[model samples]
Every structure is written in structure tokens, then in C-alpha cells.
Target: MHDPEHGDGTSLADRPHRRRAVDNQRRSAASADQVHRAMVAVRERTPTGWHAAARQHIDGALHAFEVEPVSGCIDAVACLIPPRCGFCGWRVQVGTYRIGFAVYRDGGARVASFATAGDALGAAIRAVGKEIAGTAHR
Candidate 1:
């Protein structure tokens, strides 16, 4: 007997299973695309170099060697050192400089020079948070 619904001799019982399999494949593809977009967004928002390093140190991903208040420089100054590597230490110096605040990494690599130290610190913190959150999403 011909099954009008299926047209062919294929069992009615098999139709639902095939439909489900097709649906699952579509859903999986959509999920993968969403993940790729999220990763791209995170990459675009996150900063690189010493800013990133400083963020990692603040987030506890890298060990902090020292974070201390300084004198004879700016109104408010703080120096941070990441853990030593052999004999070399990575440092982040944030302080008021000239007309604004300046954040410098080791060897005078400037992460950013902003109107306020708060702005610089906020930028670093936001970058680190985005990185950590992005990994979690992945």
C-alpha cells in the first residue's frame, strides 16, 4: 500500500527522527556562528601589549611583585611590578605627568596617557574583564 503522507514506502516512524536530526544540525551551525562573532567582539575590544599585561597582573593571572605609592613625582603615583623573570621585572607605572596621567610599562613603553589615572586604570580593568569573560563564553 502507498503511504500518501510519505509518498514513498518509507516508514512513518522514521520521519520524525529525520526531522529532528535536521533541526539539530541547523541549531549547531547557528551556535557556532554566534560563538565566532563573540570572539571577534572580544578581540576588538581588548587592548594589547603592556595594557594587557597590567590587566592580567591585576586579575591575578600574573603574579604581582610590588604595588606601592611613590614620591617626588606627581600628585598621586603608584608603581606596580609583575613577578620577576630570572633577573628582569615587568613594571607598570601610573601617575600624573605634565598635564595629565601617564601609564608606562617596563622600558618606558607607554600603555596610555590620559587626563586622569582613573581613566587609565578603568581601561586596563575593562580589557581584562572582557578577556576573562570572553574565555568563559567560549
Candidate 2:
């Protein structure tokens, strides 16, 4: 005779499964709307001078990175948004100067400056997405 329950009183199947992509390390959890908007920002392709073949290869890989299970990052775009701030490790702020917006990383060092908040945030999002995409493939 044998017991289905382990000595610890819990079975292996009783453990809660978690998505590796959205684990607490990825900012607790993001709402579906938040994830969708972030996906739009992540999927945007910035113009680059690459051969068509290379671009196609990269695009396919990116598509896989954005698919179900992972769905890319929930909020890879970090910004002190007017409504709410996205937490993506990187820090961002809309500045008060001739330059409108900027991103910061590694302890207050400025990453970039943009004429518009949207541009700054988009660039940051694209960068984060690119990094995640690269890791997802390799």
C-alpha cells in the first residue's frame, strides 16, 4: 500500500505553475490592456539599413518572441507616464527643458534625449524588446 500524498502533505502536481515571463522578477503582474499596449510598442520596427534577408530572419524570430506563453515583456518600456509609470528596470522621465523627454539607466546616467515623450519612450521600449528578443532566440 502507498499514499498519493507526499510526506510533506503536498503532491508535486499541487505546486502552482508560473509563466517564466511574468514571474515576480518581471514586475509582479501586468494587466492585459497594459500588456497589449506594451506589445504594440515592442512590435514597432525602427528603420534600419539591413538586407531584406536579414530583416526577414530577424522579424520571424521577433514574432516567435512575441507569441503566446511568453508574449514578450509586459512593460519593457519604462517611463514616468502621466497616468502611471511602467517598471522595466530602466528609468525614464519627461524633462523640463528645450529637450522634452529622456531615459536613464545605471544610476542616473542619461540614456537618450528626445524632442517628444513618445519618442523617448518608444526608443526605450524598442531597445528592451530587442534585448529580450535576442535572449529568447538564443
Question: Which numbered prediction scores highest in TM-score against the true structure?
Answer: 1
Model 1 lDDT vs. the true structure? 0.38
Residues 17-125 of candidate 2 have per-residue lDDT tens digits of: 3233324323322323343444444345323321111111232121111211134333232332212233333234432212334444447755544433345445544
lDDT of each: 0.38, 0.35
Question: Could you tell me which residue pairs clash in candidate 2?
Answer: none
What number of clashing residue pairs does each candidate have, in the order they appear?
A: 0, 0
Q: Against the true structure, what is each candidate's TM-score?
A: 0.27, 0.26
Model 2, C-alpha of 87: deviation from truth (Å): 20
Give the lowest summed-lDDT range of ten residues in model 2: 49-58
Please identify model 2 stretches exceeding 4 Å from their true place.
1-77, 80-110
Give stretches of model 1 more than 4 Å off. Answer: 1-9, 45-138
